[model samples]
Target chain A: MNAIEIKNLVKTYKGGVKALKGVDLCVAQGDFFALLGANGAGKTTLIGILTGLVNKTGGQVKIFGNDIDVDFEGAKKSIGVVPQEFNFHMFERVQDIVVNQAGYFGIDDSIAVRDSEGILKRVGLWEKRRAIARTLSGGMKRRLMIARGLIHHPRMLILDEPTAGVDVELRHGMWEYLRHINAQGTTILLTTHYLEEVEQMCRNCAIIKEGEIVLLDNVRHLLTRMPQDTYRVTLKERISLEKAQAFNAVKVDDHTLDIEIKKREELNEVILRLAQSGFVITDFHPKGNRLEKLFLEIVSK
Target chain B: MKREYYIALKTILRKETTRILRIWTQTLLPPLITQTLYFVIFGKFIGSQVRSINGIGYMAFIVPGLVMMAVISSAYGNVVASFYGAKFQRNIEEILVSPTPDWVVITGYVLGGIVRGVLVGVLVFAVSLCFAHPMVTHAWAVVLFTLLSSILFSLAALINGIFARNFDEVAFFQNFILTPLIYLGGVFYSIHSLPKVWQEISLYNPLVYMVNGFRYGFFGFSDVDPGVCLLILLGLTVVLTCINLFLFKKGIGLKN
Candidate 1:
């Protein structure tokens, strides 16, 4: 069975603001599925529904084939959520926050306390265990949230923009920790605006726009589906726009021309034509698929 | 079903008690100070001129009313502020998503409010001893009435917290509705001393019955039967508790 399944999910706020129109998604167990979208794109809304934070307007959600509404307790036990906002009690210490979360899952104090220490240490927060949550920095607080979410050893972990506002080093560190956990048989569902993070971490990807799923496929396959390839040709001499236009290329500047080639063979043909025109090609390279392009393509359509 | 509910209830109650204990200065001190002033200004200075009320000295007569007044306000204020603070900080989502049931959440917060209320009431009672010789004529009745009244107000506060959109909304209900009811509910004088029309109207206020019953426990005297007061308090608790639980289940203010 899939780890998490959402079908025909819909959410509309009180003011008739339809945040989620209809979103259908399926994530297999042990898959690091990244749900990519811009701000206000319903990624958080979807997480909220799955975690039971937001009530669904209409639809069905299941965890391991157990209906969310009918078997909510069982579904909740399998899912852990680290929300975008820092939501821990300000007065609660790091250790207490983690252990209390375990207690909420019906785990006794002895086991909860032991697991709390281990999880806090795993997230590099053990030394600061007694510090109040409000005293932690933004990055450290995010790590604390991760530790609290994992205290119960849930089967699935859902992270919403976990790396936002985090330094690159810490972001990478979080990715490594999350990867280790994912490798240990915990399915991960991540929603992040950072395209590079998605590219580096996710095996499968889904992009949502305006409350609807625009694309859902393997990350590698999605990257290959770019309609246009951008190639930068660095000329030995500044070429005139008139001359560059003759070869059906857009002159980005006097020395650089961004050319669109239909096929690999067309690349050599363009270079030969440029050479025949007495224009020396200093460097030539094709730009790989990027999230900016993917986002524009999906949102614009 | 029973086991889960029991566990959730126990945890919530424990957490609430801990919160009050952790912040006794804020939760337990203000009311003790206020009651002291009330005893000095009203019981000592003002009661010197006024005759005995309802066959009891003015100072002893108003003791139960003052105690009930403290319990009601503190009980309501504790839950409204604590629960709404959780909402404001977005920490309520932790419990909202947990395996705990909706009623369990409601009961837990209500129980917290009751603890604060009873604690404040105890503090005020201790302070009142300095002004007048207030005796508990029936220990069981005093305990019963105190617990019941605290629960009633606590449930009301939970409902207020759930429906409140901001801190202003939380304060609005307490400042306007709760405070007025507490002061007008025969805290300073017996309702019988009021005009005939006002006496009939005071019966509509729920706090009046609570004060009268609480006074009955203190002095073995009351304008109304103690059984009637108990029934009214229990009824209010059941009705408000059901409303709070329903609001929680529907995710009324929290989900939005």
Candidate 2:
């Protein structure tokens, strides 16, 4: 069964702003799926409809095979949501915020208290349990929301940009924790602008463009479809601009070269040509994330 | 109600009660201080010179009205401010996204208001004891009026909270509407003392019945029959609760 099944989803705001126009997609159970969209691309609106925050003009949404319109309570109880914004009360204590969220799901106080300790510790916020939400830093606040979302132990965890502004260390820590949970058969649905995170974490992804699903494919297959690859090479010796322009190269400095190659064969050809030019390559790396380039191309269409 | 939904209601009430106690200075103390001032100035300092009405001292005559005033304001203020705060902070999404039904959510907030309203009412009545000894002639009427009136006001406050876009909107309803109606509800003096037309006009104000019915419970003296007042309170409670439930079901104010 799919974790989420959206059929003909549509949302038009009061002023006739069409946020989602007949979007159809599904995420398989236990899959780490990514929904990639630019700002105002209706990602949040889709999540809102799923979580019952926004009313849907037309759609049939199901979670774990339960239709939201028919069995909304069942669907709601099956998934836990971490919204993009800091939505918890600012004056509430960190521990209370998490436990109270569990209470709304009808979890007993004693059990919520028991689960909050593990979740807060996993999110690296146990020490700050007594602190007020407003006093926490930006990243800690996000983590608090994560802890609150996970308190109910929902089958599916839908995160809307959960780690957008978090530091690298904490972001990686969250990634590891998410991976651990996913391995335990918890389906993860994520929406984020960080294409690198998508590449590193998501197994399957759908790119939504202007309320439509433009692409739905495995992340690996999507990466394989990149028509061109760009690389930056550190050269052992300086190469003349005239010689460097063969592979559509741009000179970073005297000894550094940025190049875009059309095919894998072209890379070898460029390397042979560079070796022939009496310059050896010291280091080489991709200039940009592969998914980002594809996402830009898809969204701009 | 489902067992789980009952648990959710208890959680909301627990949170609200904690907030009421945690900010005692704002929620509990201010009402006591304000009612204390009202008792001192209106009941003790001034009522000594005024003649008795209905064979009862003027101080005792105003006790039920004072107590009712506190109950109405506290009940209205608690729900409006608490629900509005949840909206302003956007934390209300926590409950909206949960499996809890809309009715449970509404009942939870209304019950919270009742807790605060009754606490303030009891405290104000206790304070009134020092200035005037208003005996409770009917225990059942006291319980029913206090609970029902607070329920009505709490439901009204939720409606206001839904329509309010800012703090000013919240305060406007309390000040321009609720406060004036409460004062004109015969809190300080009997509506019978007013001219016949004014007494008739005062009957149109809903608070008049609530205040007088609650007073009837205390001193067994009221301008309107206690039965009629109770029927009005009961009818209003039913109609307002239906309106609130309809608003929640339709997602008016709280949802898109």
TM-score of each: 0.91, 0.98
lDDT of 1 by residue, B141-185 (tens): 888988898888888888888888888999899889998888889
Instruction: Flag regions of model 2 displaced more than 4 Å.
Output: A266-273
Which candidate gets the maximum lDDT versus the true structure? 2
TM-score of predicted structure 2: 0.98
Pairs that collide in candidate 1 are none
Candidate 1 chain A weakest ten by summed lDDT: A260-269
Tens-digit lDDT track of model 2 for B1-256 = 7778988999899999999998989999999999999889988899999999989998998888889999999999999999999999999999999999988999999999999999999999888888888889987888888998999999999999988999999999998999999999999999989999999999999999998888888888788898999999889889988998898777788877
> Over the stretch A161-261, how does candidate 2's per-residue lDDT look in tens digits?
98888899989988998999999999999999999999999999999989989999999999989988889999988778886776579988888888887
Tell the DockQ for candidate 1.
0.50
Regions of model 1 farther than 4 Å from truth = A227-289, B1-7
List RMSD in Å for every model shown.
Answer: 3.2, 1.4
